[model samples]
Target: MAGTSEMIDLKSTPHSLVENFNLMKGLLATYGPDELQVLREKAFRNFTEFGIPTTKDEEFKYLSLRALEDGRFAPAYGATIDRFELEQSVLGPIDAINVVFINGEYAPELSSAHALPKGVFIGSLKDGFTVYEEVILEHLGKIANLTGKLGSTNDERFVYLNTAYLTDGAFVYLPKGVSLEQPIHLIYLSKADHGPLVSYPRTLIVLGENSDAKLLESYLGMDGVYFTNAVTEVVMGESAILEHTKFQQEKLESVHIAATSIHQSEDSIYTNNNINFGGHIARNDVNVWLDGEHTETWLNGASVGLGHQAIDNHTRIDHAKPNCNSFEVYKAILGDHALGVFNGKIFVYEDAQKTDAKQTNKAILLSPTATINTKPQLEIFADDVKCTHGATIGQLREDSMFYLQSRGIPKDEARGLLVYAFAAEVLEKVTIASAREVLENALFAKLKESQDMPEKGGE
Candidate 1:
């Protein structure tokens, strides 16, 4: 393996370099013959052609994939963990059916399966892929095509790396007319006794026609600093409704990159909520495609960064058909030299008439050294469409702060109240009241860090 300086050759694409290509090949060599053949024949071509993306690429400009070039991480160890111990360590207080991954290995003992109603299938994709390989082949790798779109770096390499060493992740299937009463929880945890640990977790959720469900995916880490690269693909059938939330709560020393893609059919409703709170460097790519008419989609996110942490979110919502609707709102709170990046793109096709799309991104920098870069883009080809996008970057409203202070509330309390109100827009959308309260309390705990400052010379 080559070091960071020699991994990505500036003059040439990553895959063209002998070391990068060989490393890619060596990574595949560990997998089964069938898996190796599948990746090499199906996805490896994309990596070979484009190499990895650099800062010159507009979409990946903010995210530094260079970390992967460092060759400092190794695949996580597969260890046997007690079911009760794993559950206690990871799930915390979330209320849902649990699917746990320990050290990148699936722990069946820690998972619970309530008899899913008719038209619902929830389990490991690897199991389904092994037992129902034909079904898996139909939808896998359908969204992120191999063709070099954003300067030749598709997620295929990382995804292929995942496939090469994947132990297991959840696979959810909702049949036509089915409704899941309880949310499905998928948790990924890494215990980093071995240095240079890397874990790739993948999930695929398929919702049939007229189906409704909610999914919560969470990530947590142990003492050792590790790397987690995850991918989730969602396919929503006609008139299907899906409320999906992905929460990242790794340790401060961790590095994580995740990609979430949703494909919607006609009249389908898909809502995606992403929350990020930890990681040394974190990046998320969220993409939703409206393939059929009358589709409705919502993209909402909240992220808080402290210390030297960095969070980057790149999202794309494509209006491919007619009469589709989409709304997006993203909020970020940065402090103590943390960095936040928000890049969102909305594309309306030529035939996407009567499309209604709106997007807004707001950021609050609690520290002067904190930074945020926000960009929202719209490409519309239809004339009969309602599209709007706007972004704002600043600190909390001082006037609101002053108003609260004047009402006899202390300045710290006033700031927390105003900041909580600003974030309430997204928090209110939490479907489960219990889940909402948990997240709300977590936000408060984080905000308290800003409030609990020492008085200057006893005030």
Candidate 2:
């Protein structure tokens, strides 16, 4: 342990970020759980091997980590947030099984407490080690391709960083033949009380055969400099179904990065809708694998970037078996010098005959200075598979704007309406009614605030 701690490459690590290494070392040495010691060490070793990601890496070519690396970020603990503030952060009133986390520590008092059905579990990841020992042991590090595990080398460095300090997070499980009528909401709130704060939020979800459930994860933090690095892994049994949504509204001055991995079995279905409204430097990496025949995957997302914020979304779906299908659609709205990026990839294996896959990404830039970078790729080795991918980047159409203005709407309102309709195309796919309402409200509000955007074509 001492050797590995000393081996952490300092050259690649920033001076202020070294405290995190020391913090992880102390936590592991003093009171780390016995069952997870090896996993923690392996994850730390991976971080030691590669401290942080830079633009030099192909995956991070367009995204920059300067703001996150140079800041002094210490893990925030026991943060006391007001009930009113917590309530206001939510986009809408959704009667969900709410689980609240204040600065990465589970807050039972703030969360909704209820007894789930038999063979189902919902609680913090810390207690889950004992409460759901067998399930945790089996699927904890299986998904996300733990870079922490030896002999593995492909992953964004933050995933390993989050794993090394993964003590508390949200965990949910369902046995065969069970279904959850109410969606589970994991709400995270962050405050930089002492100084620039840092928190790692981790999650693991497992679904048994023939079971179905819905999950939503939301993040909203106070106006301060902070970093939220999160990772979530999911596994679906044969014929299982899951509806997943992630709502991120971090303050534009903060740093946020999340990686989500999903594995689906035979006849299973998985759907994801990730919405991003605010963040100084936000990045979402979602990966899915269709490991069984007749499985289906759907991925949709929308991002609104403003005020120099850099928001990036990277997604990949792999068809490994026959008769599998996958679809992805992502949209973005950028203004006031903001930067938005979208990269989607689909891979169809040789054995994945009869596979169908499609991917599309579109972005609307509202200012001459605002920018959008999009790349859609498809790789199909199977001769009988159908695969296609495309991306489009452009400003608002003048014809539509004129039509709306000539009718009765103001220029700003007309622009907002046009942008809203474009983004709502993707958000409308969210299965939860309340969730869709919340998403639509947030999208319009974001669009409304940027009404001063230069006229179409930067008049």
Candidate 3:
């Protein structure tokens, strides 16, 4: 690391990621400046300066990175995967134009982008560097840089890592006044049939003025003890409307870390729904910056943690201009010894006089051993702004459970029903019918499994 005085030795560090820096640099050498080589160099330098984050870091204070720090995972390069198996993991109906990536590399044979509307570009980031260099160069890594926005922090290091290893993910570009009738699906699956592996999936979306679109970014795994470090950046032009949904369902043995940054222009609207049901250790960072007046932003998230799983959701919504409106609601259901963490911050700058922002986080603990930590904060510098934030952590209400049980429902069934109702609030916010249906089914299935476990005193 450059900022730190001590040099981290790749040979001594457990599961050391620095060992692959040479390989990554070699890969970058193959591309010219037009292909993002310069940006990659800058990001790699930042990663080296910051180094890997530890539990001691405030941003990662609750979650431990030991699994990622100690486990040796080879970079997934040219890993083979079955298309049929990939198809089986689609979240919704298989009719939409889907862009599939296996092991962090774009697989055109498994993707369906042929039916996209005119003036809408959907393809791989690797190709976007060459085909859409101007757009990629303008937006890529601009948000990942943390110097001016959030300041120096360990959480930003992951973005630097993704920028350095940026290979192939999804790229969507909508020109002015274009509207897509069907949603675009970007599917990323990590299948480590070869061995323990690591992959970086990067996505960039640009929507021009008055453009409208819906996009789904899904991360899935097919039986692997691997690591997924993914980053997505979205830029919305004036009067643009984008409904974005992110679903993470990696295997229980894998580790997943993701960062999504969205920038909105004047009078634009951005709605996001994030759902997590898998991954042994998962952390999600979502940030939205409202830079223009009259912009609207909505964020809703739901996570289910069972067994010893650990899931964390961190979000920030910045109201930089006047008359901007933002709302956020995040819910979680934890069972067994699982742990869930939620930290949401809403910021209203001095010039954002008419900003209206609200944030709420709620969690339900199903077992006595299950745990949840939630913090909702609002920083308002604008005098006329309306901002409120709150969080609640508790188990299901005994009276509600008793009422359901008195209505002839079994104890397990009553518990399951309560859990479903609590989680469904966020799932219902998903505007995509197909995606909502899939999430509803997955939520219940998880609740049912939790209900089967032995009773705990928390109930």
Per-residue CA lDDT of model 2 for 42-121, tens digit only, reads: 77777767666677566676888888656578766577776677767645457788888888889898788888999788
Minimal lDDT window, size 10, model 1 = 450-459
Per-prediction TM-score? 0.87, 0.92, 0.92
Superposition TM-score, candidate 2 onto the true structure? 0.92
Task: State the TM-score for model 3.
Answer: 0.92
Residue 198, candidate 1: Cα error in Å is: 1.2
Q: Candidate 1: what lDDT?
A: 0.73
Which digits, one per residue and each the tens of the lDDT, describe model 3 over residues 1-459? 123433232344543466676666787567535446676677777766666666566677678777876758888866666666664554645456788898998988888748656667898876776677788888987865444553233257788878777767788999999998888889888888877888999899999999998888889887678999999999999999999989899998999999999999999999999999989999999999888999999999999999989999989887888999999999998989998999887877888898999898998887889989887767778899888888888878999989988988888767767778898988888777887777787776666667444332233
Q: Rank the candidates by TM-score, best first.
A: 3, 2, 1
In the range 16-76, model 1's lDDT, one tens digit per residue, is: 2224334456554644335535654444443444444555555566666665666566556
The models' CA-based lDDT, in order, is 0.73, 0.81, 0.81
Clash-forming residue pairs, model 3:
1-48, 2-49
Residue pairs with backbone overlap in model 1: none
Q: Name the candidate, 1 or 3, with the larger TM-score value.
A: 3
209 in model 1: Cα distance from truth in Å?
Answer: 0.6
